[model samples]
Target: MITDPVNRFIEALHCFPALPRVFNPWFSVDPEHDASSLAPTHRIDNLSRYLTERLGRAKVILIAEAPGYQGCHFSGIPMTSERILLGQLTHKGIYPGDVLSGEVTRCSRTDGPVGRRGAKEPTATVVWQAIKTAGLDPRECVLWNAFAFHPFDTDMLTNRKPSSDELRDGLPMLHQLLELFPDAQRVAIGKVSKGILDKLDIPTSAELRHPANGGITAFRTGFAEYVGRL
Candidate 1:
């Protein structure tokens, strides 16, 4: 049985059936095809352990829509991609190898070229950059998604917006996170996230634009405003 709250949280995510065919960083492993798929759990677990140590400290919770195929689907950390997983981001404390051994192969996307070592997702880059630009310490915040799992299109390579039913299923895990960090101020990172929070009756400190498509500038501006208020 998992005793620690952090591990238990991971366990809860592992058990949730957000989609019929899902890639769970906490439990699923594809050794032959992509061993790196197995590394996200370790990366996320290390992050949880760090957050556990910072319990009672003033923190912020940033909730986004859901994991992107090139982001949390592999890194297991929201607002992060494989580049961040390999310690390429300014915040290296959440590296996948921090708690696990062996080299993690950088898996290529279905539409991407092969042999890529550190691929980056545009959204991840923008989110992290916005966080840094806002003068917020990455360690002082916890990032998650309203829908914790990746929802793909028929191609399974392309990302699709999660359905209402899927988002509803993910509510329990979000609630579990809130139970663990009751004092942390919550911030929804997009319309979907804010809508879900509203449905759950969970109050938030702010709602920032999501840094995707052409919303990078708006995202940065909104994040800066939120940070300025802090």
Candidate 2:
């Protein structure tokens, strides 16, 4: 019996629709990107363990627009990358302990687009930094995405905004996540995420600019003010 909230949440994620050009990190396997045949299972384990460690400790739910190829596509955790999970990259005050109790592994092929372990998303780095600046432990915050999958065009390496219809596929999992962390304050990281949250009647504590595309400074400023309150 999957009675654990984190386990149940992961089970729901496994049942998500397999949309075209959209990669479900917790289930999808890309020979071109994955390091081995077990990469998909590894991703699921990563997410399950991550959520398990933070269960009942989350104070905020940071919802971003969508997963990026260099970010959640490899890490399983939203707004996070392999480098950060593997302890290759660490922020000052955030993640002082092992992200997954020393179980983190590289799921991306070494020769993949970003090369080496896996590509690191600038936005992921900034998000962690913002958390550190807020003086909050990483476990106190749960990072999620409006569209939990990586949406792309013809090229798997590139990222694209998910259409409304595609975003609908993420609704079930999103609702499940909110239900899992009902007490945590919701914070939207971009306009798209904020719009979705607003339309769904989900109250959000803050709607800050995304740290990508030259919005670093603005995002840092906005995130500090909003997340600081929590």
Q: Which candidate leads the pack in lDDT? A: 2
The TM-score that candidate 2 achieves is 0.93
lDDT of 2 by residue, 73-162 (tens): 888888887878776675444352545666666898888676784678788888888887777777888899887889988877889998
In the range 1-230, model 1's lDDT, one tens digit per residue, is 88888778877877766366555555555343244554555555645664575457547888988777677665566777777656665462344443233454454333343124455678877877776667776656677788777777754345777788877777788888887788888999888889888987889989988877688899999988887777
Candidate 2: list runs displaced more than 4 Å: 91-98
Candidate with top TM-score is 2
Score every model by TM-score.
0.81, 0.93
Candidate 1's TM-score? 0.81
For each candidate, the alpha-carbon lDDT, in order, equals 0.68, 0.81
Query: What are the clash counts of all predictions, listed in order?
Result: 0, 0
The 10-residue segment with the lowest total lDDT in model 2: 90-99
lDDT measured at residue 212 in model 2 versus the true structure, 0 to 100: 71
